[model samples]
Every structure is written in C-alpha cells, then in structure tokens.
Target: MSVLPLVFTSGWASGINAYAVVLLLGVFGATGLADEVPESLQRTDVLVVAGLLFLCEAVADKIPYVDSAWDTVHTVVRPVAGAVVAALLAGTSGSLPELAAGAVGGSTALMSHLVKAGTRMAVNTSPEPFSNVGVSVAEDLGVAGVITLAVFHPVAAAVVAGSLLLLGMVILVFLASRIRRFLRRRAQRREERSLAGAGRHRPHG
Candidate 1:
C-alpha cells in the first residue's frame, strides 16, 4: 500500500492535535508498533519534545480563552508539523517525493486547522468552559484513534479522516452566519453588562 494515505490521514489529524499525532507516531515507531514510520521521528529528543507539548495542549485546550490563544500560536506550528511528519513518513519508504508529501500534509492540516479554530471561536462565545473542554477532548481522542488506526490500517483510517474533514467543513460553512450572529450577540450582552455595572457604581442624589 502507498504511504500517501497514511500521510494524508496524519496531516488531517495533526490539524486537530498535532502534538498527539507526533507523540503517538514517535512512540509507535520507536516501539516497532508502526514499522513504516521514520527512525528520525522516533528519536529520544523528538519524543520528549512532542510529549511535553502534548501535555501542555492537554491542559490549555480545556480552558476557554486559553484554548483560543493556544490555537493561535499553533496556526503556523501545526501545518509545519504536518508537513514535517509527511516528509519523514515519505522518507521511510521512498515511495513518494518529500515535496509532494509535504504539500499534501500542509494543505490538509491548514484546512482542518481553520475548521477547528473557527469552531472554537464560536464555542468561545458561550460563557461556560465545559463546551471548550468537551470539544478539546473529542479532538484529542480523534487524533489518537486515527493515528492508531493508521498504524495498522492506513487506507481505512484515511477514508475515515477524509470523510470527517469533509463533514466538518460542510458544517462550518452551514453555520458560519449563525456563528457570526452568536458572537455578535455575546459581545452586545457583555457591553450591556458593563454599562449596567457602571450605572450601579455612579453617585446617586
């Protein structure tokens, strides 16, 4: 089987949780669980760095505004990571050229990352933190599951990942207007609260 499918799947997964994909691929490759993964990715230094970043994401992703900030920082990081992962994967087999692999990985990661960031922005309009935590957990699990499946069933994993990416993009487009209105309403509410609070604090006759 061509390694392209697995590369695409991993790239898509990286958009959601790049660190998890990196950490898992490193551990799996090092442990001989995923033979097609590159040795370079399995190095001790790579694993440690990926692990630490994954841990940081695990915590930051659960918080409301913090998650957005984290996502912002990762806008460039995730796509680059995806491209790097793809290049490494291609190097393992020499089946695909590194530039082509990198292009596929980087573009897929950007698409999924945009969907993720947009969804998070809409979720942030809500004052509660639970939704953020819930979405973050789901993304983390999705990344783990897809990567695990890619180790043994790369084709199947790619199909599933592609379907998911399509569905997410469709949903995001469908709800774009709604999300915008929701955010506007939330901002207006916050302004009203601020005005009310100011009135309460003013000196009265």
Candidate 2:
C-alpha cells in the first residue's frame, strides 16, 4: 500500500498538534508497529524532543486565550513539520514524488491550522474556561486516534481526516464573524486598559 494516505492523515493531525503527531509516529516506528514510518522519526533524540513539546502543548492548549497564542506560534511550525514528515515518508516508499507529497502535506496542514486557530479564537470569546479545556482534550484525542488509525488502515484514516478537515472548514466559515468580533473586543479592552494606565501615571495639574 502507498504511504500517501498516511502522510495526508499525519498532515491533518500535525495541524492540530504537530508534537503529538511526531511523538506518536516515532513510537509507532520504534515499536515496529508501522514500517511506513521513517527511521529518522524513531531516533531517541527526536522522540525526546517531541515528547517534551507534546507535554507543553497539552498544558498550554487547555488554557483560554493561551491556546490561541500557542496556535499562533505554531502557524509556521506545524506546516513545516507536516511537509518534512511527508517528504520523508515519500522518500522511503519511492511510490510517490517527494515534492508532490510535501506540497500536499504542507497545504493540508496550513488549512487545518487555520481552522484550529479560527475556532480557538471564537471559543475564547466565551467567558468560561471549561470549554477551552474540553476542546483541547478533544483535539488531543482526535489526533492520537487518527494517527494510530493511519498506521493500521491508511485509506480509512485518510477518509476520516478529510471529513474532519472539511467539517472544521465549515465550522470556521460559520464562526468567522464571531472570531472577528472577539478580536475587535479584545483589542478594545487592551486599548482601554492602556489609556487607564496612562491616565493614572499622568502628573496632576
């Protein structure tokens, strides 16, 4: 079987949590669960770094507003990770061209990351923190489930990942206005706080 489907699935998962995808794939490779995974991914150093980053993301992703900041920081990192992983997978199998696989992986990651970021922005508009934690947990489980599935059943995993990507895009479209409003309100609050601080610091006549 070709590795392209697994690559695409990984790209989708990477967008949500690159570190989790890396850690899971490394474990799969090291344990001989999946031969399609690259040996480079199974390196001890790679596993260690991915594990640490995954733990960091797990905590940061559960906090309101903080997840959005983390997502912003990963905007470039996720897509790059996806592309590199895909390229390595393609290079291993020799079934597909590496450049094409890289493009597919990178583009998919970017789109998925946008959906995640936009959704988080909309979620942050809410007052409670529980929803953020809930969403983060869901994403983590979803990434683990999909990545594991991709190893055993690549085609099925790709179908599931594609469906999720489509659903997220639809949700983003629905929440676009809400996300924009949330950003505007957040900026307004920051400006108000800044002005208040300035007033307090000003000299009295």
Candidate 3:
C-alpha cells in the first residue's frame, strides 16, 4: 500500500522515459543500459518527486528576498522528501514501517536543512554581497540540474550526485578552515592593540 502510492507518485511525476533514464543512470550509469535491452523502459515515480524537489529549491533561490523566504519553506519540504524516501524504502509492509521511515526521513532532511541554512548565514556575513549571490545562484542551478538529470537517468545521476556530495564536503571543510583562520587573525590583532594601549598609558619609567 505505502509502496504503491510512492511508486505511482514518482512515476506520474517523472514520466516514463525521463524517469527510467534517471533511475537506470542513477543506479548503473549510462553504460549500464548500453547492452541488449527492451525498446522502451518505464520510469519510476520517485523520479518525478526528485525533479519537483529540485525545481522547487531552484526556483526559491531565484527570488530576491524570496530566497530567504524559500529557505523557510524548505523547512517543511526537505522533511517531506525524507518521509517519502523512507516510505518508499520501507516497502508496503505496515504502519510501523511507514512511520519509522517517515521519522528517519524527516530527521535527515531537518539536519541537512539546518546545515545548509547555517552555511548560507555565514556566507551572508561576508562583505561581498555579489559573491554570495553568485555562489547561491550557482549552487541552485547545480542542484536543480543534478536532480533533473537524476530523474531521467538515475545511474548516471547517482554518480553525479555522489561526486557533488563529495565536492560540497571538501568545499565546506575549506570554508571552515578559512573562517577559523580569519577569526584567529582578528583576535590576535585585537590583543596586540590592547597591549600597545596599556603600555602607552604607563608613566614614563
């Protein structure tokens, strides 16, 4: 029962060809379908869900202050994605299974949303608004493109997604290190100024 709705929804959203391509590519890569195969393949319902998710996020980022507003909206959207993913994974087993999947999915999405929100907040703190805006747009496009492609070719999408995740992690680490260094330098400068002021205040002796 749970699985059926999930499958149906994903399929209806993805359409046949695009969805199949996304799933197959995500799982096996383009080469995975190179060999002998049926003339036509069916798409999975999950692909549609994924595509829509990507589209929503991308669109949200485009609007001026709306990007911030959209982030708030994702507070709800991400968890839903998680729940859907969980339900689909749990199979149509039972209520307990569905609930458990939803719980896990919701939690995962929440955590991811927090991290993303925090990162953006930190980026916004920077003096360069243009950099922040440009980076934000790039991220939105990249995420949207990957999700769209993944729905059409899951195997290939999987590979691209995995690579993207890895790259994001690396970039995050680098940003964190830079932030730390910047803070340290600022602290050191403050301390030096304080010490120099104290010395100047002393009577000539």
Candidate 4:
C-alpha cells in the first residue's frame, strides 16, 4: 500500500483532533485493523498517552471560550503531530518517501486546523451552549468515522475528507461578518456589565 491516502485522510482528522486520531490509529493498528501503522505508534505507552489526552480534549472541546483557548495553544501542535504520524506511516509503507509524506500530512493538517479554529471562533460568538456541544460532538464523530474508513477505504475517505474541508472553508467565509458582529456585541455587553458593577461599588457623595 502507498499510504498516501491514509496520510491525507489522517492529516485532515489530526487537525480537528490530533489526540483522537492518534488513539484511533494506535488501537486499530494494534488490533490488526490497519497494517500500515508503524510499530512506534502501536506501543502500549503511546496508546495510553493518546487515550488520556483524547479524554481531556473530548471534555474541553465542548466548552465555549475554553475551546478557543485550547485551539490557540494547539495551533502548532496539531500540524506537527500530523507530520510525525505521516512520516511514521510512510516508513512502514516503504514505497513512499518519508519527507514527502510528512509535507503532505503537515500541509493538510495546517489547512484543516485553520478551518477548525476559525469555525470554533465563530461558534464561540454565540451565547448558547448547545451549538458548541453539537459542533464538538460532530467533529469527534467525523474524526472517528474518517479514520475507520481510511483503514479500509483510504481513497474514498480522502475524497470525503477533502469535500468536508472545502465545505468548512466556504462556511467560514460566509459567516465571517456575522461572527464579527456577534463578538462585538458580546464585548460591549461585557464592558457594560463591568461598568455597572463598578458604579454599584462607588461611594455616594
């Protein structure tokens, strides 16, 4: 197997949820579901770490502002993880060059990461909690489904992943203005609240 399709698909998944991708790939590879996964990724230590991180991410991802902060911290982490995973898969495949695989994986991860971060920022502008939770759950499911399909049908999974990336980009572009307006209103409300609180504490002349 070339591992190219897997590289592309995993990269896309990694951007949205690197820890989940790691956990899924490690579990699948360990259980004989994916043969192209490298031995390094299948180690017990790696799986344990990935599992814990994924658990933490799954919870934090549903929170409103917290998720945006988390995304800021992981702007670099996701793409690097994607490149490393791609390089490892390339090593196992033997047919693909490791550097080339890493580049493809890293670039795809970067693009998807941007999309995820942008969407989350837009979503955070909303005061309701349900939308954030809904989006987070959908991302988790999408990552899991894509990874599972990549193991058996890499090409098809890659196509699906690509389509999703395009759709996300379009949505982000269309909603940019609304996101900005929502954020401004939220900030103004917060400032007013702070001013009101200060006024209440002032001494009467």
In order, the Cα lDDT scores of the candidates are 0.89, 0.93, 0.47, 0.91
Clashing pairs in 2: none
lDDT of 1 by residue, 1-205 (tens): 5899999998999888998998899899899888988888899998999899999999998897678778889999999989999988998889999999999998999899988987887788778899988998899888999899999999999999999999999889877975786668758978999999999999998
Candidate 4 per-residue lDDT over residues 34-132, each given as its tens digit: 888888888999999999999999889999878877988999999999999999999999988999999999889999999998898888878798899
Number of clashing residue pairs in every model? 0, 0, 20, 0
* List of clashing residue pairs for candidate 1: none
- Once fitted onto the true fold, the runs of candidate 4 whose alpha carbons sit more than 4 angstroms away are 182-205
Residue 48 Cα positional deviation in candidate 3, in Å, after optimal superposition: 15
Kindly provide the TM-score of model 3 when superposed on the true structure, using C-alpha atoms. 0.44
What is model 1's C-alpha RMSD?
4.1
What's every prediction's RMSD, in angstroms? Answer: 4.1, 1.6, 12.9, 3.2
Query: Tens digits of per-residue lDDT for model 3 on 12-117?
Result: 2221112222344234322353221112222344445645655565555544444545666667665565555445444434533767656654554455454454
- Give the TM-score ranking, best first: 2, 4, 1, 3
Candidates arranged by lDDT, highest first: 2, 4, 1, 3
Candidate 4 positional error at 65, Å: 0.8
Instruction: Write down the TM-score of every candidate.
Output: 0.87, 0.94, 0.44, 0.89
| Whole-model alpha-carbon lDDT for candidate 2 | 0.93
